[model samples]
Target: MQHPLAYRMRPRNLEEVVGQQHLVGPGKIIKRMVQARLLSSMILYGPPGTGKTSIASAIAGSTKYAFRQLNAATDSKKELQIVAEEAKMSGTVVLLLDEIHRLDKTKQDFLLPLLESGEIILIGATTENPYITINPAIRSRTQIFEVYPLTPHDIQTALLRALKDKERGLGNYQVHLTSEALELFTTATAGDLRSSLNGLELAVKSTPSDENQTINIDLKTAEESIQKKTLSADKNGDGHYDVISAFQKSIRGSDTDAALHYLARLLEAGDLKSIIRRLLVTAYEDIGLANPSVCQRTVAACQVADNVGLPEARIPLADVVIELCLSPKSNSGINAIDAALNDIRSGKSGQIPNSLKDTHYKGAQKLQRGQNYHYPHNYPNDWIAQQYLPNQLQGTQYYQPKTNGKYEQALKKTYDRLYQLQNKERGHHDD
Candidate 1:
């Protein structure tokens, strides 16, 4: 009996691999490496089901070097030793290690000698970022090539082949997939080829056989087999753009649950960078003044992400999310400053009114720049009244403090004193 559609669909050669034409196409660097027998130790880093393993296999088949396989999560140091000895005797060996990041520091140290000796050309495969996950020493020794998710055209081409090919595919099933079904499969899988094909096969098997045997994979069946059709983040398109907009709005609206749900969708769809960017924006723009610390922490998280990269960086982003959501809400101060800026932009260019201008300049003395400019600290409580803006815009309320937290309380006291001084100054002007 044959295996499942996904299992059966594994590419037999580099040519059979879909969606990575840049790496496998004629004149490509990797193809050149394979052809010239000049392939170096390298890492294939990409998301799941993007053919990291298959790419490794293709390299092995095409190259003249002896190929050895191991899983870092399961293979022991003793097994590594055996492989090391084999490669030492074999002259040139291609060691293809899957989930290479799982190898602890000690285990990775075992391979350094062989790699340095030129006995083993290491090929590491990782879904997580190799730069952060793999030992830096090991990563430094190898060329890193990033593999991206398969495009819809690539998936469509593969699916059509599977439905038509007789030898190693499901041509016998004679499944006629509707356009709607194909769309659901592509969107639901989130660029995971194995997932899309598996869902396709399941949709076909579940449909009752009829004369035409036209398998229509409706949304309901797609959802049932896929367990959950988490909406994809449009990493590029308008739909993805809209969803993210809604997600950010939820956060700004203080709808914590809705924000979290949209966050989950982005995360599930592998929209890590975009999620971090939005969180950073919200930390400052939405939660500012109310909890200034939220912005600081969010920016720090972004830095951590930049320094360390994904999988590990994900934790910091998660921390920022919780802190922003649970932080006491306040937008009065944020709105106030924005309103004030609009006033400055729309109004006629105002002068540096004589009362507020600098007194140090020679001409400024004659212009009466310091005529009424009061040094607030010289007066009682460092609370003397003075106009900071142009005379016409005096007492223009820009930042209205919110009473939600300690910051606002401090602002309220400061504002009251400032207002009193402004009124006193106005009375003097009236006199």
Candidate 2:
């Protein structure tokens, strides 16, 4: 039976695994667990083809335990029961449940007892975040480890190994791969070693051999095998959050290029809702008060994006993203509100001054409510200093505006002048 190149090239042991040194490297958590033969239930999660299944297989191989593989999406509850029964009979078994995030409550309930009894060392694999998708009972019983994407160098190493190994790889063929071809494979696969190896196999198998009986793979052959880069992003997975975080940070850092790059990625992935939400948050949190108009523009852009959708939607999104990236950054407004909130939460709220209280409804002027209230419009500069905040917080300043942008600079000047006049007025009254 001929297997796929990726399957044939699956790492048989820990030493053969190409990437994820953090888990499989010397003295690491997984390595120690394997060496000590002290395995437990765990979930391996990350973008696909980062060696999650390979790691589970390696652990079982090194420990010489009975290994069983099942897909949570297609496998029936009876199949899980069979595995659990076998674990009970054999003392212990290692079950590799792929797409474990899809495990239903029925199967989860059945496996919980076996997992608790220590008869089955469950090695669940998922591309989604376990915390988000998996049942709480199952998640609480397992430790989660993230498998990162393989680096280009790591993928190259795997490619070369597959080409050189005769038993499980293309070593039987006299193949010559040019550097350009190899670079294309690595670049097009986007750190997914499986895709890279699959493309390499296709190039070698599909290309014709020369008179010398040597299969020559050039850049054109590689391109034909894998035409486009496979983006390592899942809209419902951790990659979604990661890309959004990068996009926001880039805008906050005022890196227009990087911000645009991440925006293009999100657009390519068709993550419209996340993009819209993130743009609004960035406008307020990162660009607040620096250019207040940016927030209004961002909201308008979001509306346009929702109405127009896709291909054309990218325009308004790009406009807002670039505007935010280039705008002066400030968080003074958010900080000021947070400070006020903290004081309220800590019970620092004091009684409102009688002059500022509402006296519109049937007061009859008996309570003297709002009697001495000084309307700012009645004073010069449309500003008058009377007690507005609670008496306990009357003099405490919360909004300390930054002079990062021209708009904020004008505000700072006005704020300082108003307070200066208020202090003078109070001093005169005291005299």
Error of 2 at 86 (Å): 2.0
lDDT of each: 0.76, 0.88
Q: Write the per-residue lDDT of candidate 1 for residues 65-90, one digit (tens) a residue.
A: 67778999998999889888887776
Per-model C-alpha RMSD:
13.5, 3.3
Score every model by TM-score.
Answer: 0.57, 0.86
- Name the runs in model 1 displaced over 4 angstroms: 64-68, 85-91, 205-208, 211-221, 227-431
Number of the top lDDT candidate: 2
> Tens digits of per-residue lDDT for model 2 on 306-405?
9999989999999999999999999988888999999999999999888888988896379888889998899787877766667677567778889888
- Stretches off by above 4 angstroms in model 2 are 208-212, 227-232, 293-323, 343-370, 419-431
Clashing residue pairs in candidate 2 are none
Which residue pairs in model 1 clash with each other?
234-240
